[model samples]
Target: MAKNLIQVIIAGGRVVGQAFTRALKQEYEASQRAAQRAGGGNQGRKSAANDTFTGMSLQEAKEILNVSDITDAEAIQKSYDHLFGVNEKSKGGSFYLQSKVVRAKERLDIELQSHSKQKRTDQPPDT
Candidate 1:
């Protein structure tokens, strides 16, 4: 009778252990599927639309810097420096200003490059 009881206890433990493992596996698989669905849910749409950096527009940057135009690299750089200096002194300001400076610089640089490219493209082809 004792041997039979021992056998039953051992079998029950094995069954319970297997059930726990199966439950964990199912949970892991469900999480993986959820993650995959999220990652592949939107392909055609702009990924930046929901991004944190998308909150700040170029127009807002220009207004914040008090510049009528961002075509001048010197002006952009000065504005960036001033903002960064202010950020350094104030603990209350958001670090978003640093990101804005980066975005402003990128926009200006890209515009300059495109302008130069257009000029080169418009020139007469080599003889």
Candidate 2:
């Protein structure tokens, strides 16, 4: 084997990690879209159906729920509960607004679950 046969050893780990992150993000977005499509099955209420199950970003969910910290589950639930109750259709609220509240809570739940999973994975295994 020649001593200097290879002038440079390329480290592609970072690139691979970035690509994997992008792919994961795309898959998550696709799943959200599919859920939206499946949930929008109401044919009569065109506007309500269209408004409900829309693709909601993480930031949008945080804003909708007025959540300042994503890790604070209690605060998130409190905000969600208040907004949900306030948007109840029987309480003279718009159905569209209620749907948005539901979606926002769901998006936040997804984020919390992912954060928990990441934490679990980051821990070292017991001997």
Per-residue lDDT for 5-103 in model 2, tens only?
Answer: 443222366677889999999987765665455444442233232334446766678899999898999999999889888988899887898788888
Q: TM-score of the candidate numbered 2?
A: 0.57
Clashing pairs in 2: none
RMSD vs true structure, all candidates: 10.6, 17.5
Candidate 2, residue 24: Cα displacement in angstroms equals: 20
- Model 1 regions more than 4 Å off: 1-57, 89-92, 125-127
lDDT of 1 by residue, 72-104 (tens): 768877887787777662656567776666665
Best by lDDT: 2
- CA lDDT of each prediction against the hidden true structure: 0.62, 0.73
For model 1, state the Cα shift of residue 50 in Å: 15
